[model samples]
Structure formats: structure tokens, C-alpha cells
Target: MKGRRRWRGEHRRFAAVLVLYTLLLLLLVPYALDYGARRGRADEEPLLRRCPSLEEALSEWGWEQRPPLDEEEEEEDEAGTAGAAGNGSAGAAGKRHIYLHATWRTGSSFLGELFNQHPDVFYLYEPMWHLWQALYPGDALSLQGALRDMLRALFRCDFSVLRLYAAPPAPRDPLAPAPPAADNLTTASIFGWRTNKVICSPPLCPAAPRTRGEIGLVDGAACEEKCPPRALRELEAECRKYPVVVIKDVRLLELGALLPLLREPGLNLRVVQLFRDPRAVHNSRLKARQALLRESVQVLRSRHRAEPRGSPRHQQQHLLLPPGLLGGGRASQPQHRAEFFLGGALEVICQAWLRDLLLARRAPGWLRRRYTQLRYEDLVREPRAELRRLLRFAGLTVPPALEDFVLNMTRGAAYSSDRPFLISARDAREAVHAWRERLSRQQVRQVEAACGEAMSILAYPLSSGDAR
Candidate 1:
């Protein structure tokens, strides 16, 4: 009996020790997860490395090193200056390239259209779309590099070269399953445009074929006939002839990554940084997530009906569905995907806005001169005035045609934000403040908590509770 009691006591002591160890691990788990997340974010973003000495320049925008102008570019600049001195038309001769920097769901499509509609402006809508597809869901740094490199090529009018870096669209059969969002390389997926405007544009292709309506589609015959591969010299000449080239990309929220391009010689680079209310941005992103999820399910279902159930094609289609799209062997609802993918939506949007704003604020005077910051609210509130300012900044005259286009574009009843391709100014005023109704008080608070400082800097007022 004494031996039995001693053994039982020893066992009880061991059990207690095991329980204590488990409790300790549970207590430390959250902190450990948080540390890992922070470390991962640091590795992914590395904002400090991208813009060294950010603290010193936070108060005032300054650069550590100025990009040196190459000898050839310097000579070209001098020649351009001399020509400007002799003729008043020299300003027209100097081509302007504008970068519309924005974040997702910030009304960038509308802003891009404003430039695209202009006759003199050769607008490339989201050239970085290819880059995103090429580096889909990769490290943030790699995406940034791809964005910069692609922009460099596009600005230089090197269309043939971009193909090297960008992935070719994957082959699809009528019965094949739609690729996951990351792998989808349709024209709309790769170029962010429903039409092949960039490929068929006058700068890259012959102008005569552009008159045909069907040329807008990316048909092989139309491309071969209209966009016969031009030599580099011819492409460059066409680019020089254009007064302005506008490239709008929402992925270019990282202003620091674009500093090098701002300093590129001969090519005049200007930036229009567009921002929207953080709450609105978050809400729009959620809505977009839902739309994407719905579209994915429909496509998957259609593909399922077309292909044999147990065939290799069906199996391939099943595999193509991203994990986010699938839940328990079936397509998940949009809300489920949104919740799973974007649980911290408010924080993510706020952080992105803050980072972009901070980077733009710290830009040097030279870059700042070329940079224009516009709010979506402002654009919607006074479309005419804001557009005039934009045109002036872009060095484009407000022609009567442009004025009419703006008026019609903003006032049309057919205009809806949901339809990206359709140019409509309908409900412009309401769209600016729609977030008030869409975002819950809790959601607003979350955004305000993460972005209070940025909001203040950008002149966005916070609720009393959210005020710093």
C-alpha cells in the first residue's frame, strides 16, 4: 500500500508538469504567431530598404542619391532645350508620360479613361497586368521589380520586349476549366482592358486598320494585318509623335519603387496619385472579392457541364480551382471567400494608403513638381474643375471635345462604377460618399485606428472616437 501510494503521487506530479507545459505553450502561441507575421511582412515589404533614411525625410521629402543623367540623354536634353529656345512648338515636341499611381478599387479605371479618351494621349491601361500575372502571388519585392521593369519597357515603346518578361496566355479549350484568378491570362486578365487597345494603338500598329471596329478584339488575323511587327526605330518615332503617354496602374501604390523612373532623363515622367477614403476602398475591395468569387463558380460550373466527369480534362479543371474558391468539395460562397481571404481588410487598406502617402510625401522637389495628388471625392465633387487641374498638370489644353467628353462622361445615366469599361458619370456625387452607408461603425473605427495619422495628413476627418 505504501509503494502504491508513492507511485500514484509521482504520476500525479508528472501529469501536473505536463499540464503546466501545455498551458505555457498556449500562452506563448499568439505572441509567437504575431512575431512571425511581423517578420514575414518585414521581409515581404522591406519599405525601409527601399527608401533608406525614411525618418529624416518623413518631415520633408528628400532623396539620398540623385540618379545621374547619361551622356546621351544629357545631349538630347540640351538639344531639346536649344530647339525649345528657337521654336515655341518645342514644348509640343517633348513627349510627356504620365503614371497614374493608385491602389485597388480607388476609381483608377475612371481616371485612366479620362486620359485614354484624349486624342493626343496614348494610354496604356495597366501594362503591369502582365507583370502581376508573371509573378502572381509572389513576394512584394519581385512584383515591384516586375512593375518597374515593365513600365520602363512600355515607356520606351518596347512592346516586343515586354513579351519576354510577361507570361504567354495559357491555352484554353472551349470545354477547359477556367484557370484560377492568379493564372487567368485572358486579354482582360493580362491587360486590364476588355479590348486590345494597346496592341492595336497607332503607336505600335498602322493607323488605317484601327478604323475597323472588329480590330479592337485580339483576333489573330486582325493583329497580323493591322499590327505587322514594326522595327524599334519606327516604334520610337511613333512614340515621339504623341504628345502624351499615360500608363495607369493600381499596383503602383508603392511610390518609393517609382523614384528611379521619375529621374529618368529625356522621358518626362509625371505621376497622378489617386486616393480614396480608406473605408470606401475596403468596401469596394470586398465587393470585388464577391464578384470574382461568383464569376469563378459560374465558370467552374460551365466547365464541369462541358467536360466528362471523370476525364483528365475534368480532373485538370478541378485542380485549377484555387483553394480559396473551394470549400468542402464545392464552390464556397463569396462572403466565405472574402472572410477567409480578407479578414483584416480594413488594416490592409489603411496600411497601403499610409505607405503610399508617406512615400509620396518624402519625394524630392524635382519629383514632387511632376507629382499631382488627387482625391476621388474631389474628382467626383467638382469634375470640371478637377479635370481642368489634371489637364493643366498634364500640359494638355482643354479642347472643346475634351470638355464635352468630360461633361457627357460624368452626367450620363448609363454610367456605373460596377461596369469598368462603360464610361459613365452617373451618380458621381453619391459615389464619393457611398462608404458612409456601406461601412459599419465598427469597420470605420478599424480603419481610423490603423490610418488616423494618414487621414489627418491627407485632410480626411475622423470620427470623435477615432481621433488621435
Candidate 2:
């Protein structure tokens, strides 16, 4: 009996050890996989070696002085077999890929439109938005991975790959009929502005009979007729042909997450980070809440009109009312949408601005050189000078057409945060400091208190009365 008892105890102990081992393996596997992937990428690409240091990289901008290249380095350069294939002017083909990274309410739309107006640029707006919706409420790491993968495919002009992760299965009520299967739609068609622009742009598609004012109302048939037989193939070909490909996304404030792409050899990427004053950002977000509320009301009204009364369609509309509508408490709604646009507008904007600025400052030298920081104030105040600086950073000569585009876009339009769609150069200088008149003293103080460190780093002065 004693021997049998001892055997049973040993068996229990072995089982416990095995269970613990399994749990530990589960815990560590993700980290291990991530590390391995990063290691593989580093091994495959050695673009960082060519940069040497941040100071040397910035020396090209005439920001600082550095020693000239040594005789050996010059010889290596002349032999046409020097550093990485994507280094300085020698490696820079006319082709470049640019990313404009910013947070919402930072005048990013205007900045994006600047690139969109460039004839040589194949500009994309917010391609990762669908991914965000599909992978609703994922953990930060998972979301980052999804975003990175989507961007990789996009920059490579592999549009079909997006369909794999673009739309997840929508939840259905057991009482109602099954939701419709999601179709494979091109990224441009998924976004309203992009859909209109793609249909109208002569290079991307043959122009339809649409006036500038009526461009946004283009029908599906018109777009389909103009689009190439294979949208993805044609887009990829265009990407190759264009001198520059620009992607503007406000969701890419976390600079650390994109370091790998900056170092990617094939991409030859550059970044323009746009920032606006926190007070202005906060005020703009508050104003935007009204716009969002109106949009939600419109959506509700449209649903009511489309669905028959008391039918499943109408019932589902009530049960799963869109987010920020009638205060429905659906987890999926919050998961898929930005809360900043709903409530606590000032707090969210201030915190995001501070966090993003800190993350950007911590980026390594090589990565930093690839980024050019532009203040909304500066860009609006001196459009031509800022445009020149931006083009220079991208290693492109300022063409007459580009200058004309800038002037035409901004020359006579009023500045309003609410009207991002309108391109106007009118009263641009006044918009820079308009926050002073728009925000209350208490509001400005609140913003300053939350973002004091970032404000200091960016050289934005605190108001005299609000100074701590």
C-alpha cells in the first residue's frame, strides 16, 4: 500500500510539471517568433550601415558640418559599387516613396492633398482604415502587425492581398438572415474621396464626363468603365512608372512601429510628419464632434429609409445601430471606431500629441533623418517655402507645375479646420495663431499642462497668463 501511494504522488507531480512547461511555452512563443522575424529582416537588409550616423546624414541638409568623404570612400563611390544600393543621390532613382504621418485634427488632410496634387505622385489616403475595422479591438501588437503587413503589400502594389484581411465576418443576429458576403473591392473604391479621384484622374483611368464640382457624385458604372481591366496590375504598373508614391495616414503617429520599413531596402522611404498646436488640435477636435454627430444622424435616417418598417433590416438597424448613435453599448462598435471622435475630445487629442511626439523623439538617428517635421503653422504661413523644403527633402527638384499647384490650391480660399476638403491659400498666415482667439484661457492651460514637455520640445511658447 505504501509503495502504491508513493507511485500515485509521483504521477501527480509529473503531470503538474508537464502542465507548467506547456503554459510557459505558450507564453514565450510569440516573443520568440517576433524576435526571429526581426532578426531575419536585419540579416536580409543592411541599409542602416550606409547611414553611419545621424549627424553625417543631416550634414547633407547643411544643418551641420562634417568631414568630406575620404579618398578610399570616394574611390568606392566612383567605381559605382559603394555602400547599400539605396544610399545618397547616387542610389536615389527618381522614384521615391513618401509617407505623411500625423494624428487626426492636425491638418493632415491638407497635407495629404498637397501630395495628391503632385502630377508625379500616385497618392493613397488612409489605406489601413479597412484593416483597423476588420481587426477591430485587437491587441496593440496584433494591430501593429496587421498595419505593417497591409502597408508592405500596398507599397509593393499588391492590392489583391488586402482582400485577405480587409473585411472580417460581420456579426449576425440569430433571428435575422445571414449578412451578405463581403466582396473584394479595390482600396480606392473603399474610401469615398479616393473613389472619386481615381475615377476622375486621367492617368489612373480615362476621364469620365464629370465636372470638378460633380466629381464626387460619380456612379459605379462610370468608375468601372474607366478602371483598367485588372485594377491591381494597372496600379502596380503606375506605381513603377510614377516618380513618387505617397501614402498619407493620420493613424501612423507611432514612429517606432515603422522603423523597419524606413530601413527596408526596396522601399527607399521618406517621411513627412505634420504637427499642429495642441490647443488648435483640441479646438478642432471639439468642432469635429458636431460634424460626427451630424454624420451619425444622417446614417440613422438613411437606414430607416432603406429598410422596411418592423423588418429584420429595420430591427437590426436598431439592435446594432452604428456607433455614437443613440448611445448603443455594442463592444464591436467601440472596438472598430475611434473614441476620440465621440467624447473627451480635448483630453484624447492632448494625450495623443504628447505620446506621439515623445515616440518620434526617441527614434534612432538613421530613422530620424528619413523624417521631416513640418508645423501646420509654417506650412500654411509660407506655402511656397515649405513646399520647396518638402520637395528638397524628397530629393526632387521643384518643378514649375508643383509651384503652380501649390499656388492654385491655396491662393484664394478661406482657412477653416472644418473644411479640410477645400484647398485655399487665403488668410493662411492668420490661421497659424488663430488658436489664441479660439480657445479659452482655461482650455489653453489644460492643453499646455498635458503637453508641456512636447510643446517645449517643439518650441511652442506657453501663453503668458497660463504659464505654470
Best by TM-score: 1
| lDDT score at residue 309, model 1, on the 0-100 scale | 31
Model 2 per-residue lDDT tens digits across residues 156-267: 7667655665545656667766544444444344433434354355555556565322212235567666654335556567666666677887544245456667666567
Give all TM-scores, in the order shown.
Answer: 0.63, 0.62
* Candidate 2 TM-score to native: 0.62
Best by lDDT: 1
**What are the clashing pairs of model 2?**
410-424, 410-425
Worst 10 residues of 2 by lDDT: 55-64
- Which segments of candidate 1 are over 4 A away from where they belong? 1-53, 56-62, 67-93, 165-240, 291-334, 343-346, 414-422, 464-468
Give the number of colliding residue pairs in candidate 1: 2
